[model samples]
Target: MGDALDIMQIAGVGAAALVTEMTRSSWDSMRDAVARFFRRGGEERAEQELRLIDTARQRLVDNPESGRGPVEERLHRALAIQLEAFLQAYPDAAEELQVLTDRIQGTNEGDSGGRTTVHHNSDSQIVIAGGAINASGGFHYRAPEGGR
Candidate 1:
């Protein structure tokens, strides 16, 4: 009888330990899943911003001499401002978007003839240049504040 009681106590403790370990593992997985969810959300926002920038760039290219007197400038400024605001809302993915923006802007500026070619590589880095204005240039990313 004494040996049986000892065996039961040991089994109880082992069972308790297993339950505790299972609970801990479940919590850890939940936490990781939540973190990934937020990360993916931020990435989606960043991609949206990139698309907006690309659209704006295409518009500029299509109507370079549109006599809307400074319309292109205003549009570019608005896009930048809006994108910066978006980045401020999602700092986690801001770095990549910022790098892309800077590269595009630099390429646009260096091209004296307002005609530029853009090349996006598999690595997510883009190169832009006018017919003969191909000096080495690159972009860097910046993060926004308040987790924006």
Candidate 2:
């Protein structure tokens, strides 16, 4: 009877340890996913804003009179209008992206915004960010599944 009781206690302790490890891993994965979501969202907003800027620039070059005031003035106004529209569309995501783009464009944000780093622990994160905006947005990390 004594030997049987000791064996049962050992088994219980092992099971508890396994559960703890699994829980920790699961929490880590959840945190990673949230981070990836925010990073990708920011990248998407930045890309859209950039595209708008390009389009506005081309329009200013092609048809100067139709835009706004002077060529440079028109370009600035158009860029601002387009960015405002984007922010309206995706308020939460656009806020961060606008900051990033402003930094990249050497605006008054004081960001020096050319460099950005995103860390992810899975290939899926890469696919999600890249496939959407056609830009490399996230850092890859070893996932729990060990696939990538």
Candidate 3:
């Protein structure tokens, strides 16, 4: 993550992974560490970012059966912005942030999670997608549950 774009991407992934994969016991500590890393400016911004992470985690925990695409996407985008700003203000921190990013990614990320993916060659090919497909070619997505 030496480059700005790579750093942003890694931070986004690391932030999302930390928020989603961490258990309740380790959550607080990891959140604090993340805040500390981004603590280039005042502590208020770091605290706000951590709070946002917490809120995102709560949403995923509350809706475990539902797809978290929206929450994840939003959190990733927000974290990416924060990371970009921090890196811009402190160019020397790219390597340090990369180390932290590696640590976050190294942790076992639990399951592959669940997703509703469609594959079709043409209108003639119908994807049943969690339910039996009818004769007509149409798309139906049933959210996956309990992790895949």
Candidate 4:
């Protein structure tokens, strides 16, 4: 909230929620709400952003089920960056973003039909359906002590 890193985290999580909502039946409502938030830039900027959002939605819609994981991940990352910049310019809007994030994620959670459950994980396995999972950076492993 008070620093760049915190803002980035909020933006990242918020963007993930937004992208996750894109595939839901209630997308239009959420999309319009997001556009309203972007209207801080101006009417024209808002329209342009909405078009980009529509294009991202189209990409999600066009991809086959199995191919959607990567596509969604890409879209989530892009939106996260955009949201981070927006928050940087308008720190006061973080609360508004929280409202959007809560609403979007709340609706998604309320729908139990499309939920995917993973049990007893032993490795890094990702099973993406129509939601966002934000993971960044990479893993580096080193043998403990003299084990290597």
- Top of the candidates by lDDT: 4
**Lowest summed lDDT window (length 10), candidate 3:** 123-132
TM-score list, all predictions: 0.32, 0.29, 0.56, 0.72
For residue 42, model 4's alpha carbon misses the true position, in angstroms, by: 1.9
In candidate 2, the residue pairs with backbone N, CA or C atoms under 3 Å apart (3 or more residues apart, or in different chains) clash, namely none
Q: Please give the lDDT score at residue 109 for candidate 4.
A: 71
lDDT, each prediction = 0.43, 0.42, 0.64, 0.82
Error of 4 at 142 (Å): 34
73-101: candidate 3 lDDT, tens digit per residue? 67667666767777777767677677776
Candidate 2: stretches off by over 4 Å: 1-52, 59-69, 105-148
Model 1 weakest 10-residue run by lDDT: 14-23
Cα error, candidate 4, residue 123 (Å)? 28
Which model is ahead, 1 or 3, in terms of TM-score? 3
Error of 4 at 70 (Å): 0.6
lDDT of 3: 0.64
Winner by TM-score between candidate 4 and candidate 2: 4
Winner on lDDT between 3 and 4 is 4
| Per-residue lDDT of candidate 4, residues 1-148 (tens digit) | 3588888988999989987788878888888899888888789878987888799889998998788999999999988888888888888878888888998777777775575777886545455645455648754445458642
